[model samples]
Target: MYHIRASILFCGITFVFNFVRADYLTIKEERSYADPPTGDWVTNGVITPLDQEMRNFYIRNADGVIEVLLNEDVQIGLQTRVQRGGFEERKVEFTIGGKRFSYDLPKNLYVKRMFKDAEAVRKWEERGRRPIMDGKLYLKPIADHLPTPEQPWISGKFIRENGRFIDVQIGREIFQIGTQGHDGQHRFMGLLGQKDIKPFIQQAFVHGKLRGDVFHASELCLRMLEDSKAQDDPKLGRYLFIGDSISGNYDKALRTALKGKLNIYHPPTNCGPVRKGVENIAVVRRMTNRGLVGM
Candidate 1:
């Protein structure tokens, strides 16, 4: 049996990873949390819903460095396993996804550090493999040349640090940042006057072109609709989404707003109107009955 055992030692942490014998691609991710009891760790990914309720994965590596996986591919991008050990000590038994990643180690350095190096990650992925190193920030650089002059764009980081909004510019654009608390408007609206009623337009004017990040939600929604429509009809191309809005709940309100704009953005002259709703799939049935079928 060929095995590679690596250990990383850090302040208040010690981690060990072992490649055990297995047929399936076995990748294990283990970490210790930073609470009083000290070594609370959890493993989660897209392949399986997290056994725990927390959305953010914050666990310390055996070497004490914070392990962070920013994208979805880390989970469903590759399937892995989890093995829990003693407090502050865990074992990950797995193999690289595709090719065998063998590197001559630099003497006297931590084995975990060598294995977790970015270069190693690049090499491993080059062969269509997945490495099981989690808990480190992954920042892909912005290209020196951006979109053409015709396509004016802006991008920045919206960080809410220490009760203050900080907009870190990314090359040319500045973004707005803010946070909201739970205590706000709530009422029965039971015994209200007739004048209090206004037609809910569900209007949302999303300025997606302002900066690259601003229009992501709108862009994604449109993309999904287009993909679905294209699947339904191959010859006809992509599409757009119209919505209606309620100022109360952003989630449901956005859908309502999108519903209203369907005819405007995707006029009869172009692609027909498409409404993708979350509340239920029945909305599409209603639209079809109204004679607004996809062209």
Candidate 2:
């Protein structure tokens, strides 16, 4: 038995990738959180749910399954394992696949990054392969660009010094970036009251149209929603959530989980542990504005 090992230097660190061929051939890759300098991949198959609880599922090619899971770091997006308990199973075709991708694949954002169908695998085999590397802050340009887009859209260091946005630098350009995540909910009745991003470096996709030094993306569920005040949506009617600490306790989460479907508001009067919560119901009604709710 023989193992071939290759080392790549990225950013400032070194990474070792080993290719072992024998009984069962497999490609194992390990690298920093950042993705490609540039490129993409195309795969064909229908993603099937395996175990909703474990966040496990897979794409089927010929027979069995290559069970996959949603990256724990990712909480939102089409690749999310978070069960909607959908009314019906969807026939989806590679939401992130069938397109170009770069080396800076965000495991958090591209939850299905590892999946490759037979045709895609064949393409990989035909194009060729490379070993893994280390230090995501730096990446060497690809000699032969696979998955098209021969040139990297951008390459540089990304850091979240603080707050919800990341500090990014690509060439002479310096930008603060934030990924657009899950859609929020609207709490109608009683409204009122609502993270630092992870830092990395070297090569990654900047989803949004660039503006000054900040990158804002629209739909890639990879952010944490904090607490603050609630605003009603004129499109949807408002909803009043009345309860004690239990209801109040889960109010924020309920709003997030709802994906901003309803305008949810917890009456300030019933927001905490009150000695006489039920009695406060009347107080809440009296406190709120006119015709806001029918409580």
Candidate 3:
């Protein structure tokens, strides 16, 4: 196991990454809360329904549209009250997939329940991915330089510190920063709002240049183990790859590249999505000796 300490400047912010080697490190998806409504007239909520009350509904965001299965009929529970000037304020509360969410409908907004397609629902559930925003934030990676095992990849981390926003792109994936609600927490939505991506790029990029720090996965694992000063163990330096089918391919490639170099671990079953990652984080943390790193 080895350690590499590196620093870089991004968006006028300095970020330091500590890399270490271990038998295993966890790689999971990134998850964040949907952005809050921008005005008083708009509100947000989660949908969670009872097990027996299954239904299908469509959710549209700027990036794309997806149909979600609601465990209950949501329209039947819609509540409306008269506002000033003969306007109506509509609201609904429902549960889906064990999570409760709610949304306030605009005066003229229309929502329809789609006919259930078991196969479609199954496939959607299988994807295990969710939209990062209620509307479009236009967050897309530049295709100029593709990430590879040789060069690896780096992503920007938007952090809120002392009531100010500091944006920095580190070599490691965004998920390595840890979960939300911790000190030095990082979020993509907190720094940029929905709708336009132009302004975000303009502010985050200095003179249209993006700076990134680089570290090979093996080197990172060594650094992590060394930093923890974990005692030598045959099973100590392993890397666990967990994600959906897309991520599965990545795992295979990584395993091939790192063959005979490090111990790579992955489950027979591919992990579903960010939600699944959130659910199984504790188990992954427990399995890894030095701790998990997100991708």
Candidate 4:
């Protein structure tokens, strides 16, 4: 029943800043329901260029633009990989400029796809639409070093177990999951915790590497369970809109634009106008009635 989660991150606002430059640093705060009416996360973002390097970037908040810098390494192209999936490709690919780039090391990559193109997705639709993940998902890390992806399969929540605050029976254990392929530098960043991890004893995952009789936990994924919805927090809101071909034409773009924050659902067939709506709406209504989706 444990679902995977993600590490802390946030949304961005666009603007050009003359002073201070870096790649990314944005903070967003939500209603901390755990802390109730008065509980709100106050945030300020700061990014330092590590030993690896630095880049010119702009930061922002509700008021205006903010940028912080640390190191002297602006990648000639882009540091993060831009993965692309399409009809022609059998697997999703990172937009590695040319075949030659520095720091090209092996990475853990996991993706639930048979291929990258529309045809592959269409073929999948013919089936049950279940997840079509690659076989070697999170088996182990290629590099046996500290801060490896697979080593930190850890998370937990505290409950009164026997007599102590042992989270033997806790919520989702699937935080910070990832995968890697042997052939390429492609890595898959699966799930991450919503917040920065705390100490191992309290709100973090209380597990570790199997060495002798001791457990060694280098990093931990932190989580706060919701009362009504168990440990899972549905971050995005799903909305259904019925319309003609116009809506259908822009459907993909709309979804792409609002990728992570919200999801927009539509019927299989376009509902068209009022008279058309009457017929198609019934199908949609049946779908909704059966707990498929809602308005």
After superposition, the stretches of candidate 2 with alpha carbons farther than 4 Å from their true spots are 1-149, 161-164, 183-295
Q: Report the number of clashing residue pairs per model.
A: 21, 29, 34, 22
Per-residue C-alpha lDDT of model 3 across residues 179-262, encoded as one tens digit per residue: 122222212221122112111011111000111211011000000001111222355454544444454346556657767665
Q: Of the candidates numbered 1 and 2, which has the greater TM-score value?
A: 2
Shift of residue 128 alpha carbon in model 2, Å:
36
Q: What's the CA error at residue 261 for candidate 2, in Å?
A: 31
Lowest lDDT block of 10, candidate 1: 215-224
lDDT of 1 by residue, 1-295 (tens): 3343323221213334443322222223222222111122332111111124322122211222122222222211111222222101322232331222222211111101112234444554466532222111112222322222332222233222222222333356533222111221111111122222111101111101112211111100000011123223334322232223321223343335545343212211111122122111112212222332322
What's the distance in Å from true for residue 145, model 2? 14
Residues 213-261 of candidate 4: C-alpha lDDT, one tens digit per residue: 2222322222221111121126755544455445345655555786666
Q: State how far residue 65 of model 4 sits from its true place (Å).
A: 56
* lDDT for each residue of candidate 2 in 1-295, tens digit (9 for 90 to 100): 3344433222223345443423321111221112232122111122333454524333322222223333333222222111121112321122221232212222111001121234543454465532211112212231221222332222245333223333444445444433222222110100100121211100111222223322223212221111112345556644544454453355556568655575554443433333243223321111123323422
TM-score of each: 0.15, 0.19, 0.18, 0.19
List the candidate 1 regions with Cα displacement exceeding 4 Å. Answer: 1-149, 161-166, 171-218, 222-282, 285-295
TM-score of 4: 0.19
lDDT of each: 0.22, 0.28, 0.26, 0.26
Q: What is the full ranking by lDDT, best candidate first?
A: 2, 4, 3, 1
Candidate 3: residue 98 Cα off by (Å): 36
